[model samples]
Target: MVVTVPRVSGQVRDALAAAALAVCAAVAAAVWPEVRPLDAPGLLLLAGVHAPLAVLRRWPGRALASLVVLALPYHLLQYQHHALVPAEVIALFGYAVLGRRVRVVLSVVALLLLTCVVGMAMRAGGGSVREQIAVIEGVVAIAIAVQVWRSHRARVAAITERAERAERTREQEARRRVAEERLRIARDLHDLLAHSITLIGVQAGAAAHLVRGDRPVDRGELGEALASIAATCRDARTELRGTLQVLRGADGGPPEVLPGIAGIAGLAEAARAAGLTVVLDDEGAGTPPPEVGVAAYRIVQEALTNVVKHAAATTVEVGLARDGDRLAVRVADDGRGPAGGSPRGFGLLGMIERARSVGGTLDAGPRAGGGFTVTALLPVADVGSVTPR
Candidate 1:
C-alpha cells in the first residue's frame, strides 16, 4: 500500500513539516558516524544537502540532482564508511513518483546503487553484507510503490472531471425541455379558452336580442342561452383537464390551432354582438406573414377583452395598413380616459412582449382625441421569406 499525506484540517501542514525535518535529522545522525576520521566540517556541509530534499516536490529534478552532486565531495575526501545510499534512494523515488521522470529516476538509481556497492568493496567496512542488501531492497520497493500510486491518482482525476461535465450537460438539457413544455401549454390555453369564450359571447348576444321586446321573458330564449353556456363550460373543462395532466408530469398532448388574421373578423363580430360596435379598415396591399397575422389577431383579441372588462364605450376601430415594407396594426377604443394616460395591468406589457418575440415593435397609450390605442409594426416578411402555417 502507498502512504500519502492526508488532507487533514488544522495544524496538519505544520505537523508534516516538523515530522519530515525530524526524519531528515535522524538520517543525518546515522550517516554522520560513517564519514568520521575525516574533516568534520566538510562532512557536515555535505549532510546539509538533505535540507533541500524536504521540499522535493517544489523542485524535483533540481533537488534530486543537487543531492547527488553534494554526495561526490564526501567520496572524493575518502571519508571513512561514507554511504550515499539513503539520500540517493529517496531522491530517485521522489523523481519517479511526483516528477514522473522515469528515465532520470532509473538512471539515478542504477548509478547510486553501483557507487555504494563499489565503495563497500573498496572500504572493507565491518558492517554485515546482509544489512547493505536489505537497504537496497527497501529503496526498490519504495520506488515501485510510488510509481503505482502516481498512476492511480492520474486516472482518478480524469474520471472525476468527465463525470462532472456530463452531469452539467444533462441538467441543461432537462431545463430546456421543461421550458418548451410550458410554452406549449400556454399556447393550448390561449386556443381553447379564447375560442370557447368568444363563442359564448356570440350565443348570449343572440339570446338576449330574441327576448328583448318580449313582455316578461321568452323561456325558449333563456333555455338556449343556458345550453350554450353549458357547452362552452364543458369545452373549457376538457382543455383545462389536459393542461393539468401535463402540469402533473404527464407527457403533453397535441398542439392547439392558434388564431391568425382570418379569425380577427370573427373577433370583431363577437364584439359587435356584445353591444360594442366595431369597424375594421384593412388597407394592407400584400399578404402578411403568418406570425404577423397571429400578432394582429392577438392584439385585437386583447383589446376587445379589455373593452368588455373595463371600457363602457359603444364603438371601437381596428385599422391595418402596409406602410412601405412594414405591416402596421392599430386598435382604438372610444372609451372614457384622458388622452396620453397610462393603462393599468400587464395587458399592454403582454402585447409588447408578443410583438417583440416576432421582431416587431408595439406601443399602447391614450389617443390624442378620445380613448386608448394599441399600435404594432411587424416585418412584412422575415429575411424576404415567409414561414408557412
Candidate 2:
C-alpha cells in the first residue's frame, strides 16, 4: 500500500522554516571562531532579522524591508555579519519571486548600493575588488532565475485555462446534438401514430355505424373495415420496430429505407381511404437529395394529418412542382382552418422543423378564399449548397 502524506499549510511551513533558520544562526554565532560572542542586544537583532521570514509570502515587500532595517543595525553594531547572511538571502528570494518586478528591481538596487557603501566605510583600507564582483554576480544570477520561473508559471496557467475552455465547448456541443436527436425521434413517433390511428379510428367508426343501424349488419363491409384496421396496425408495428432498431444502432440488418417525396402518393391514398378526397398533382419534380426528400415527405404527411383531424372540408389538393433548383409542395384543403385562430400543436411545429432541417421553408395559414393551406419550398440541389436554418 502507498502512504499519503498530509499537506502542510503555507503559514505552518513558513513558521517552521523561520524557526530552523534562527536556530542555525544562533548555533553558528556561538561556534564559529570569526564571529563575536552573542550579547543580549546582538540576540535581539538576530531575532528581528529572521522573524519576518514567517510572513514573507503574505507580505514580501514589508518582510524584506524589515530584514534590511535590522541587518543594517546588526552590521553597524559589529555583530557577527555572517550569522544572519542566510536569513537575508531568504528574504531577498521571497521579494524577487513574489513582489512586482519594478518594485523588486528598485529595492534590490538601493539595498546593494547601501551595502557597498557600508562595506567600504567599515574597511578603512578598502575591500577587495574580487569580493565586490562576486556579490554583484550572485545577485544578478538570482534575479535571472526568478524571472525565468515566473515566466514558466504564467505559461502553465494560460495553457490550463485554454484546456478548460475547450472541454466546456465540447460538452455544450454534445448536449445540443442529443437534444436534436430527441426532437427527431419525437416527430417520427407523432407522424407514425397520428396518421395510422386516425385512419383506424375512421374505419372502426364506419363499421360501428353499420352494426348499430336498424337494418341487419353488412358482414361484407364489416369484414373490409376489420381488414383495413389490421393492415394499418401491422404497418405501424413494422415501422416502430425499424425505428427502435435504428435507435439501438444494431448491425444485424441493413438500415431501414425512409420514405421520400415519391411516397407522397401513399399518403394521399391513405387519406382517401379515411373519406377525404385527395388530389395529387406531380409536375415531374426530379429526384432530390435524401435529406430533402425525407423532409418533403414528412411535411406533406403532417399537413394531411392536420387536415383530417381539424379541417372539416372533404377535399385536399397536394401539388408538387419543380422550378430550377427549387421543389415547391402545397397542400390545400377546402375546409375551415383551425377551430381557433391558428394551430396550437406540435404537428405544425414538427413540419416547420423538418423543412428547416434540410434548408427549406414552410408556411401554413388560412387561405383568403376559405380553407387552410401549407406551402413548403425545398432545395432540390446538393444539400451542401444550402445552409441549414
Top lDDT model = 2
Q: What is the TM-score of each predicted model, taking all chains together? A: 0.57, 0.78
Error of 1 at 250 (Å): 13
Global lDDT of each candidate: 0.65, 0.79
On residues 1-389, what C-alpha lDDT tens digit does candidate 2 reach at each position? 99999999999899899989998998877676232477888888888889999999998888877877887777555555568767877777677678776345645655664675456456523343344334445654555565566668778989999999999999998998899889889988998888788888887887888889999988997898788788878877877787787788878878677778888888888788678999999767678887888888888888898888888879999998886788898999999889774788899999988888878888989998889999999887777776554
Pick the TM-score winner: 2
lDDT of 1 by residue, 85-171 (tens): 566566766777667566556556556755765665465454634445455556556666766676677789889999999999999
Candidate 2 ranges with C-alpha deviation above 4 Å:
1-51, 65-85, 92-127, 385-389
Question: In candidate 1, where is summed lDDT lowest over 10 consecutive residues?
Answer: 75-84
Off-target runs (Cα >4 Å) in candidate 1 are: 1-47, 51-170, 173-177, 180-184, 187-214, 218-257, 283-285, 337-340, 383-389
RMSD (CA, angstroms), candidate 2: 5.5
